[model samples]
Target: MPCDKSANADPKKEFFIDVITMDIDYPDCILDLIDNSVDAYTRSEIDDPQIRVTFGEDSLEIYDNCGGISEHDLLNTVFRFGGHVAHDSTDTLGIYGVGLKRAIFKIGNAFEFETYDGVNHNIVYENDLSEWKTRDDDEDGKWRFKVRAGAELDQETHGFSELRITKLKDSYKKMVTLDAKIIEEISIKYVLFMNRGLSFWVDNLKIEPLFNFEVLSNEYLQPSVKLLEKDGLKVKIVCTYNPRESLRSEREEGRYGWNVFCNDRLILLSNTTKETGWGELGNIAFHQLYYPFCGYVFINSHDVRKLPVKTTKNGLVTSDNTYKFILNEMWNQATPVLKYLRTSRLMDEETLIKDAEKSANEKVLQDSKLARSNADQKSIFSMNEKASFKAPDMKPKRKELTKIQYSRPTVQVDKVKRKLGAESNKKVGELTFDLFYDEECDDA
Candidate 1:
């Protein structure tokens, strides 16, 4: 064989620089960038964190006081896919690095990021979708995106990063009117963040808290048992019901399970709708033993995926055992409470009326205490007397009976009369009279 230099040569090419690019649709790109902000905030250990969003007709900006990316890391790894520091680590909230770029590409034509890297070193990048579609053979096949050195960055400013997206898509034009509402919705959806030191703002309005209970202290029920070994399992059961009203229609059906979280971040929310055994037993009106209210029994710290239930972000698909176990525990706890309430006369109509009357009398006395400070105390007392005099005399109505009927007895005397022969009966009576009735007959 002739000597061939190319046959023995390595074909792979190596590059020294670390820049990667991908195209993303507008709002989606923006969302991915926000995810990056959230991950960064979580990593910094800044408790009760908040992210600020501001936008106008031409531009949109998101700012967060998270642990900003370091200058060296930003240049080398931040933009590259699969470069996340938290990958494969269950404690942290970040995964693939695609979120940052995906967010930028989805929302705007051009985007810039500035991070506090001891000193600020801003990076500006622009994407031209039209250029991406049309490139000649001589040009590099990679998508057309440009990155360049940015101006002096500030570092003394505790840690911060800002992403600004401009050159809006047509779909985003309507969003200008709904920015506040969107923030509100997101805040409600991620209400757990209120306990995790995460806060969100849109324009000037701060999102109000949406949860009724404290996430760590009250929202999470106490465990019945703790798992000591790898195979150990813990179960929690909670049931609540509305006594005065049904919040949902009777036509609506399904079990409502919460999003499970480990270390303050959401792992998954259930995607199933089948009622657990506990739900079926708890839902009965007569079995007020269990409060059938809107709450969840969270099996804390366990990988619930082990249960035979299909879970997605929306609902849970529960199997027989999971439901059965939950129902058994719930009934065990709730039955006593229901019995106590019933025995205490709390559920009785007459008891409630008496309690109401007592309450009203107490209120009147309380109002009299305040009358010393009132300018129209005498008039108020006079009005009370007049109202009492005008009260109508009424009697409680009794329920009426609809009809009455009587039936004769099935047994008759004719059969008994035929069984006794008259002649034999008289002879026996005469023999008895001769022996015992002599004194009674003489007196008669």
Candidate 2:
């Protein structure tokens, strides 16, 4: 009897490609690549950081004048799937090193990286990617980039990286459309960077910092610090609430929420609902409340494991205790302001905050401190079903059934497989996911 051992092997090329491209659309993929460029600026502390994106008929490219990649990083870091990087900087957006590579595989079959530092200019790409994986281990497996004195790089932009994704894959050709929602999301996500002198351009058009909904009545409550001893977490919170008339009640919870940031990068764009921390604490019906609210929680932590984000970097795990503390803090200050907004009914937002700030400070501080203590586990302001009159649960009476069941009618679905129609390289009658193209952008 003998124990059998399996040999280690590289993942098959198609499986690797498919896994790399999962769970992200074109807009998110493009944004991931930009995150790397932003990290360069964060690391180098470069002033006047500029990111330019261009749309080509059959290709797309991203250009940034940040720090350029070196030979070692080009070969080992950038091209390597699942390239490992440690979470070294709290301020930098990049943690996982797979962003740029995944983005490339998402958009096109082959892409080129053109970069220049003060001394060297470099270019790298691999054609026929599938061939590399099939090559025998004994054959030379080394693949390195080409470096030269001048690589079509401008002298003025000495230190920079330019990524061009070309030869569009059949599945990703519609990425060129550039939807309005994508632009709005980018503008909101990067407003702080834009304010700090980073210029972001999309297809020769400059993206402006999107403005928040106007506040009617407001209050700048005393800032709060909550220390969760068991978790070793600290949250510093500042909050503002809109007046009763500021937001349309009919419009519901439209954009009234927390804009949470960790080390200055936005983690949760809008934490605006009961599950997001407002439900039990605020007590007021979310959709019925006249006043809208928003706030920020700047976090400092002893343990990086407690960070309130997923690897995708799209949003916070709002269910985490850290976010729950923040939402609760915002609600404590918001209660009095909402009460005033209802009774006083002020037209001017400025005067409301000024007035609320004077009266709410003491209560806000006491509640915030008490929340951290084990002695007072329950928030006094929060509502219980018995104390606050919640409607009694009544189960619906079951309908009597006797010989009433019948089988559903059979519906036939026509499934047709087709190839791309008259495409230069594709066979006739190629089928794509049926996306609706007739609907136009509201302004377009």
RMSD of each: 21.9, 17.2
**Candidate 2 residue-wise lDDT, 166-248, digit = tens:** 87777776554564655666687776667667888887788886543322221222222232322555555544443333435
> Which runs of model 2 end up more than 4 angstroms from their true locations?
1-4, 7-10, 84-90, 130-157, 179-181, 212-235, 243-255, 280-285, 288-290, 299-306, 319-444
What are the TM-scores, per candidate, against the unseen true structure? 0.51, 0.64
Worst 10 residues of 2 by lDDT: 386-395
lDDT of 1 by residue, 1-444 (tens): 866556534221111111222333344444455666766765676645678888778778888888677876776667654566543232333345556655554455667777774465556465553343243323443332345555655545567788887786566666655575556544544455554557777786777645433111111121112112122234443332222211122311112232333323333332122243322533323322122222334343233333333222222344546545554554554444333322221222232334445555544333222321223212111121111001011112223634433333334322221221112333323333433543345422
Please tell me which predicted candidate would have the highest lDDT against the true structure.
2
Q: List runs of model 1 lying over 4 Å from the truth.
A: 1-31, 81-83, 87-90, 127-129, 132-145, 153-155, 215-272, 275-292, 296-444
lDDT scores in order: 0.43, 0.55
Count of residue pairs whose backbone atoms collide, per candidate = 25, 9
